[model samples]
Target: MKILVAAAAGMSTSLMVRKMEEYMTANGLVGVVDAVSVAEAKERIRECDVVLVAPQVRFELAGLHQIAEPLRIPVGGIPAPIFAGMKGEEAVRLAQDLIAQAAEPTS
Candidate 1:
C-alpha cells in the first residue's frame, strides 16, 4: 500500500510520515508513505492507495475527493488532535480503515 500525506507546505508532514513508517516497520507492514503538497497530491494521487490531508488543509479535501473518488482511492482528513499531536499509529489505523471501507461493496 502506498499512502500519501498532504499538508500546506508538505514539510510539516515529514515527521508524521516518519512516525508512520516506524509504526509500519514495528508491525511488519509493508508500504510506502510520502509527504506532498496539495498541488503535488493531485498529480501523485494515482500512485497512492490512500490520501490523508493534514487538518490545516482539510479545506482541500473536497477538491481532492473530486480526483480520488473517480479512481476509487480513499481520501480523508487527519483528525486535528491526531495531527497536532503527530500521532502516527492512529493515522496509520485510519488509513487502514479507509482502505478497508473502499474494498467493501456499496449497498
Candidate 2:
C-alpha cells in the first residue's frame, strides 16, 4: 500500500516521510510513502491508500476528505508531535490500524 503525507510546504512532511520509511524498513512493512504540498496532494491522492495531513493544515481536512472519500481511501491529520518528531513507524502502524478497523464490520 502507498501512503501520502501532506503539509503546507511539504518540507516538514518530507522529514516525516523519512521517519516513516525507517519504521517501515525496520518493521518489515511492505509499503511506499511520500510527502507533497497540498497542490501536489490533489494529484497524488488518487494513487495513495491513505492520506495524512499535517496538523498545521487542519483547515483543509474537510476538502481533502471529500476528495479522498470517493476513492474509498482514508484521510486525516497527524498530531503535531508525531509529524515534528518524524515517527515514521508509528505513522505506518497508525495507517495499518485504520485500514484494519475499516475492514471490520461494525455492530
Candidate 3:
C-alpha cells in the first residue's frame, strides 16, 4: 500500500514518516509512504492507496475526502496521541483498517 501522510506544512511529518518507514521495514510491509503538505497531498491523491492526515490537521479531513471519495482512496485522521508518540505500527494498522473499511460494501 502506498500511504500518503500529510500535515499542514509537511515539515513536522518527516519524523512520523521515518518511524513508519522503519516499522514497515521491520515488519516486511512492502509499500512507499510519503510525507507531504496538504496541498501536495491533494495533488498526489491519485497516486496513493491511502491518505493519513496528521492529528493537528484533522480539520482538513472533509476537504481531503472530496478528492479521495471520488478517486476511491481511503483517507483518515491519525489519532493525536498515537501520532505524538510516533507509533508507526499502530498508525499503519489504522491506515490498513481504513482501506479495508473503504472496500466494504455500504448498504
Candidate 4:
C-alpha cells in the first residue's frame, strides 16, 4: 500500500512521514509513505492507495475528495491531536481503515 500525506510546509511533516515508515517496517508491512504539500496532493493522489490530510490543511479535504472519490481512492484528515502528537501508528491505522472501507462492496 502507498500512503500519501498532505501537509503545510514544515520539517515536522517529514518527521511524521519517517515515523509512519518506521511503523510500517516494524510491523512487516510492505508499503510506501510520502509527504507532500497540499498543492501537490491532487497530482500525486493517483499514485497512492490513500491520502491523509494534516490538521492544518483540513480545509482542503473537500477539494481532495472531489478528485479521490471518482477514482475510488479514500481521503481523510488526520485528527488535530494525532497530527500534533505525530502519532504515526494511529495515522497509519486510519489509512488502513479507509482502504478497507473502500474495498468493501456496497450492500
Candidate 5:
C-alpha cells in the first residue's frame, strides 16, 4: 500500500512519515508512506492507496475527498491526539483500516 500524508507546508508530516516508515519496517509491511504539500498531494493521489491530512490542516479533508472519491481512494484527517503524539503504529493501523474499507464494495 502507498499512503500520502499532506500538511500545510508539507514539513511537519515528514516526522509522521518517518514514524510510519519505522512501523512498516518493524512489521515487514511493503507499504510506502510519504509527505507532500496539498498541491503536490493532488498530483500524487492516484499513486497512493490512502491519503491522510495532518490535524493542523484537517479542514482540507473536504477538498481532499473531492479528489480521492473519484479515484476510489480513501482520504481522512489524522486524529489530532495521535498525530500530535506521533503514534506511528496507530497511524499505520488507521491507514490499514482505510485501505481495507476502500477494498470493500459499497453498494
Candidate 6:
C-alpha cells in the first residue's frame, strides 16, 4: 500500500511519515510512505492507497475526501492521541483497518 501523510506544509508531517515508515518496516508490511503538503496531496492522491491527514489539518479532511473518495482511497485524520507521542503502531493499525474497509465492497 502507498500511504501519504499531509499537512499545511510537508515538513511537519515528516515526523509522522517516519513513524509510519518505521511501523511498516517493523510490522513486515510492504508499502511506501510519503509526506506532502495538502496541495501536493491533491496531485498525489491517486498515486496513494491511503491518505492520512495530520491532526492539525483535520479541517481539511473534507477537501481530501473530495479528491480521494472517488478514487476509493481511504483518507483519515491522525488521531489526537496518536499524534501526541502515542505508539506509531496504533496509527499504523488505524490506517491498516481503513485500507481493509476500503477494499471491501459496500453491501
In order, candidate lDDTs are 0.93, 0.80, 0.90, 0.93, 0.89, 0.84
Q: Which order, best to worst by lDDT?
A: 1, 4, 3, 5, 6, 2
After superposing candidate 1 on the true structure, give the runs of residues whose Cα lies further than 4 Å from its correct spot: none
Per-residue lDDT over 1-107 for candidate 6, one digit per residue giving the tens place of the 0 to 100 score: 88888887645467777887888898899998887888999998989888888888899899999988988999999988887674567878888889999999998
- TM-scores of all models? 0.96, 0.87, 0.93, 0.96, 0.94, 0.91
Tens-digit lDDT track of model 3 for 1-107: 99999897555588888888899999999998898888899999999999999998899999999999988899999999988999998889988899999999989
Q: List the residue pairs that clash in candidate 3.
A: none
Report RMSD (Å) for each prediction in the order shown: 0.9, 1.7, 1.2, 0.8, 1.1, 1.5
Question: How well is each residue in 1-107 modelled by candidate 1, as lDDT tens digits?
Answer: 89999888655688899989999999999999998899999999999999999998899999999999999999999999998788989999999999999999999
RMSD of model 6 against the true structure: 1.5
Structural RMSD, model 1? 0.9
TM-score of candidate 4 to 2 decimals: 0.96
TM-score for candidate 6, please give it.
0.91
Model 6, residue 24: displacement in angstroms?
1.4
Question: Higher TM-score: candidate 2 or 6?
Answer: 6
Clashing pairs in 6: none
Q: Write the per-residue lDDT of candidate 2 for residues 1-107, one digit (tens) a residue.
A: 78888788656777788888888888788888887777788788889888888888878889888888777778878877777777776778788876666567669
Q: Which regions of candidate 6 are displaced past 4 Å? A: 10-12
Model 4: residue 62 alpha-carbon error in angstroms? 0.1
